[model samples]
Target chain A: MMKQKNVNKRHLRNDILLIIVLLLVAATGAAYLFLFRGFGDVVKVTVDGELYGVYSLSQDRTEDISTGEDGRQLNRLVIREGKAFIQTATCPDGICAAHRAIFRNGESIVCLPHGVVVTVTTAQTQGEPDVVV
Target chain B: MRNKSKTTAFMGLFTALALILAYVEVLLPPLFASLPGIKMGLPNIILVFLLYRRSACSAIVVSLLRIALVTMLFGNVMALLYSLAGGILSLVVMILLRRWNVLSTVGVSVAGGVAHNVGQILMAMLLLETAELGFYLVVLTVAGTLAGVFVGLCGSALIRKIPANFLFLDK
Candidate 1:
């Protein structure tokens, strides 16, 4: 009985230690990501790794993003008040549509089924070459 | 022979329970509106229980079975991939933690939950071809931790209520 009690105590301590460690890691990461993030000026949309478009967040407009052959899939991206979000999507899950607007640098809304991703980025550090023919 | 059949029956019952829990979670609205992918990890409660009561092999088999059945019933191919990644990673973490015997069900489940989110996020990064998706992990980790604690509490309670020998018949 004494041994069992000791083992239980050890397990309890381990549990607390593990939880505290995980929480600490998460909190630190969050602090870094949130505190250092900057407001974005442009919304970058990509479809299947290809540059779809780069729209100024300052412009309030809706763009019809049609993907897939014959343009069957569609995700309506709306940029307004310097925030970007998917107003509507034809994807099954509709997760991206439900996602909250993103205006901070590196924030994104992803539609996995449609292979659509909209990211907010500052003007200086935007990757993916501008599609200029 | 009887014990073998009893074990099989128990496994089946556990699978059914996990499926019911998954369905229940689906029926409920998203836990956090801002966090689209956050879930209660309700099925994980059974996973933790099985890990403690039965062998890791049984728990793995049950986890895979539950994911497969859930995919066929309500999810698509993409969902299948995500579930497989998360389920396998979480199960592996839980198994190792349980084997170490340092932490009890709650700790094991907590690690499992965090690992699950990490696996899913990794898979998302790969499939979406976007490294920026990793940004979601900061918030996702917090959600995973909370879900882990809740599921862990339920799992420990379940472990206490259910006896080890209940799944096997004594000759």
Candidate 2:
């Protein structure tokens, strides 16, 4: 019984150690990513893994992005005052629509159901004509 | 022979309980509006319980059954893909960690939770063909770890209530 109690204590220590290690790893990765990212110059949108369009952040416009069959799916991306956000979406969950405006490099609004990803980027994205309007 | 039947009955009961938990999660709104797939992982309590009490095989069985049923009831084909990836990956990690015997149930569950998120992110990257989604793992790791700790605590509490002898014959 004494040995069993000792083993349990060791197990608890290991558990706490494991949690700390994993959390530290995650925190490190987050810090690295957060530090490297900067203010973006354009908003890039992709639908179902394909490039849909790229709009300059300086442009102020509401783009009706349609996807799926007969353009049945839609996500309205609005870029205003150098910030980009989804104003509305036909996606069931509306997760992307609820996302706050993103202006930092690598920041994104993802719509899983619709397979839409709107990302803010500083680098030039290859694909589709850049819509500067 | 009776013992075999008892195990099967218990498995069924646990599966049902996990399904109920999954349904409950569906009813709850998204925990974080921006993070689409970060679940409370209520079903994980049952997974952890089965892992510690019965056998890894039983835990896998229950996990797969829960995912299959949830997909039919509350999700689509895409959802199935994500769940399948996450569930199997997490279970594999949990089983391996449990074998090491160095950590408690909470630690095993925490590993499982993190693995689940990592697996799902991998699947998302494959499906979307964009590595950018990898960034989500940072946030998901934190969420998964917390969920794992919660589920692990619950599983430990449950195990305390009914020791292995109450339900199973000694191997």
Candidate 3:
């Protein structure tokens, strides 16, 4: 009985350790994502594992991105005031639409049902075409 | 009347319970719409119970059955893919933790939740082919841990109420 009790104590202690380890890892990642993140120069959209297009953040415009086999207009990605947001999407969940405007490097909005991803990237350079206009 | 029938019945009951929970989870508005990975993990309670009482193989079978039934009934094919990935990953983590015996039920469940999120995100990355999307991992992990604690408590409480001889895990 004494050995059993000792073993129980060790298990409980390890459980606490597991929780700490997970939270610690999360905090470290959060620091990188929120604090150390840099402002991105372009918004890159991907559809079905292919690069749909790259839009410069300096330009302001609305783009209708069509998806699925029928090529129906599914998601609308808008870039304005140097920020990008999913203005609209035909997905049932609307998760991308609800996502906040993103402008930092490594920030992105993913629409799972529609297989769309809009990511802010550091690829901005002077020679880039002004695609918005 | 034999041992085989008893195990089958137990697995069936657990599978049904898990499916009901999955359905209810879908009916409820997702808690975190901002990120796709946030889940209450209510069905995990059943999985945890199975892992603790029954063999790991039985637990995995029950978990997969629940996902299949839930997806067939209320979700699409893609949803099934995501659930299968998440369910298997979570089951593996929980079983490993249980085997180590270094953590209690709550710890095992917490690990399960985090693994579930990781697995689903991996499936998304594979489907979408965008590696950059993993940036949201931190947020998803945090939400998963919070949900895990709640589900783990429920599982531990339920385990206490259920009879030890119920699963017939031992010969």
Per-model TM-score, in order, reads 0.93, 0.92, 0.91
Q: What is the Cα root-mean-square deviation between model 2 and the actual structure?
A: 2.2
What are the per-model DockQ values?
Answer: 0.70, 0.62, 0.70
Clashing pairs in 2: none
For model 1, state the Cα shift of residue B160 in Å. 0.8
Top model number, TM-score? 1
What DockQ does candidate 2 have relative to the true complex? 0.62
What ranking of all candidate models by TM-score puts the best one first? 1, 2, 3
Which stretches of candidate 1 lie above 4 Å from their native place?
Answer: A127-129, B1-4, B169-171
Q: Which stretches of model 2 miss by more than 4 angstroms?
A: A123-133, B1-4, B33-36, B168-171
Residues A24-56 of candidate 1: C-alpha lDDT, one tens digit per residue: 887887777678887888988888777788888
Q: CA lDDT of B123 in candidate 2?
A: 88
DockQ of 3: 0.70
lDDT of 3 by residue, A1-133 (tens): 9998998798788878888898999999878877887788888888878878888888898999898999884899999999999998898777788888999888999998889999888764424565422
Worst 10 residues of 2 chain A by lDDT: A124-133
Model 1: per-residue Cα lDDT over B29-121, one tens digit each: 998887786899999998888787777877887899999999999999989999999999999999988888888788888889999999998
